[model samples]
Target chain A: MEKITSLADLKRIKEQVQSKIKLREQSASAEKLVQIRVGMATCGIASGAKETMSFLIEETEHQAIDAVITQTGCMGYCYAEPTVEVTLPGRQPVIFGHVNRERAREIIDRYIIKGELIDGMIPVNFKTIDE
Target chain B: MKTIADHILDIVQNSTRAGANLIEIIVVEDRKRNLYVVEIQDNGAGMSPEVLKQATNPFFTSRKTRKVGLGLSLLKQNAEQAGGGLQLFSAPGKGTTVQATFQFDHLDRPAPGDLAEVFLLAAIGHDKVRFCYRHTTGSGSFSIDTAELAETLGEVSLAVGEVRRAVAELIQNNLEAIGATR
Candidate 1:
């Protein structure tokens, strides 16, 4: 693949990606993009949050999901390291634990895309991964 | 942090939490000089003298949720283990800068994990804040300024799939070009 070396290259990318942005903007929920926060603290990184985060970024890109993925500090759920909090449009944010690459894909497919809760949905004071 | 890339992400989070609107990550590797330097500078809410004094202690933290702040301590450990040291500078309201230096050929130096992935993740989600990365090796140097990238992006978000891919590729290619290790 060719290297992206200059600001002109980014300008070209912006032009190429504009059509897709326009298509989404024309929809009723144009202002709403899925928001994902991956924990990247020591515990999260130790548990492979970097891999989880990179996978989420690639998967969302490949699937063309209108989502913004970002990193956050630990959410006090160190036991469930590599946790991901997903917020869909106006829905309440859902945090999923033990979100390895497999679980991240499942979250995107089942929870974010289909609006169905998966097994890893975390609740307060619960250690599901331990049991 | 397991690798230099991981530590970059972890410490950048600390800057974000401090309400830093501008974060600078710099890495310089010169084998001839035997110097491997990693620095993070932020224009965030700085720490007080008392807090700064104990900042490297694992048990001292500003967050109410936990009693331990291991970010600095761990980085300090990593630096010392690699035949270098960590330096910190901060003021009450100015900002904070964390710099860690290592011997370029030190056996204990952590591997350079994935710099591209780390850079990509750092720039996303914080539209208001700007993250700039400057990486240099003996061969050459490369840099990414979010302010310039934002101008090019216009209203498009950095997290957009194609844009994200492009930015990641840009960082990766630049890193390789500069003779940076993976």
Candidate 2:
């Protein structure tokens, strides 16, 4: 697999992904359905982000929280390298820091399931274009 | 490193950071049989035999800034905890493959996190590396070739907001079909 080196290369990749959109939709309906984002920046990896992310994935399926967990690069908070942002349907996105499997479970239970705010949040700073 | 995706993103970085020109990420989910597998392969400067053997140890790292390398070690642990396992294979100059498997029915098994976002990040974040993402669920599967996507968009960033949203929607629909819901 050669790394894509340019925007041209990326465009080509996206086109390939588009053809598979139908399959993706089918899979989503059959499997679990929650949106999870794990920070995988260099700092995050160094801080045990892998374990944290995997924990979230495994647990969601185990508990069946209607979830789809994925990874993102560099949330820009190096100090909180292993951070996780979870968003359930009809809920605001919540960012949790220093998360391990234990914390992941708590987030799933309290936030994802019960819609309760948990303790380890980094104050929201950046605003998306939507906001 | 507990979640499979987190572990994957971290490990994949090693390949990119090492100047890997091509990277492939494959994810398979089997609902009928109850299994989920993730494999990341890269053609970068592979680790030496000795380094490969020690890569799973928390204390061994190739980086100078840190005295410990917990990425692979913690990933292995997370896999085991979820009634799954992890493996790493590498050859100097050839490339490396890291695979992790989980029993979907196990109480410890995690859910499928957002993958579309991950794919976009991998494609857009690293301008010099090529990423190939293949996702499968039971009877169906799809692939994303960053190189191909780039070719289609032309003179524009293929990873634009629209592309990101579409990918996200695609993932959402796939998970839904599989009866995955939060």
Highest TM-score against the true fold, candidate: 1
DockQ of each: 0.52, 0.08
Which lDDT tens digits does candidate 1 get at residues A1-131?
A: 45686778878988988876755445436348888888888788889998998899889878878777777887677788898888888877778999999999999999988998789778773321210
lDDT of 2 by residue, B1-182 (tens): 43555566777777776668799998888777677788999999898999889988887877654566666777777678778899888998889999988787787766555566556666654656789877777666667677776566644443344455554565555545544422
Candidate 1 lDDT at B139 equals 92
Separately for all candidates shown, the number of backbone clashes (residues 3 or more apart, or on different chains) is: 0, 91
Please name the candidate that would achieve the greatest lDDT relative to the true structure.
1
The sequence of per-residue lDDT tens digits that candidate 1 reaches over residues B1-182 is 88998898888888888999999999999789898999999998999989889999998888765677888899899999999999999997799999999898899999988887787777874667898999989999999989988899887877777888788888887788778976
Model 2 CAPRI rating: incorrect
The 10-residue segment with the lowest total lDDT in model 2 chain B: B154-163
| Segments in model 2 whose C-alpha atoms lie over 4 Å from true places | A1-42, A45-131, B174-182
**lDDT per residue as tens, model 2, A1-131:** 43443444445556766564333345555334566777765577668765676567557656755565555655456676578877666556667887877887788888888887779887773431110
Error of 2 at A121 (Å): 21
- lDDT at B51 for candidate 2? 88
Q: How large an RMSD does model 1 have?
A: 3.5
Angstrom error of the Cα, residue B3, model 1: value is 1.2
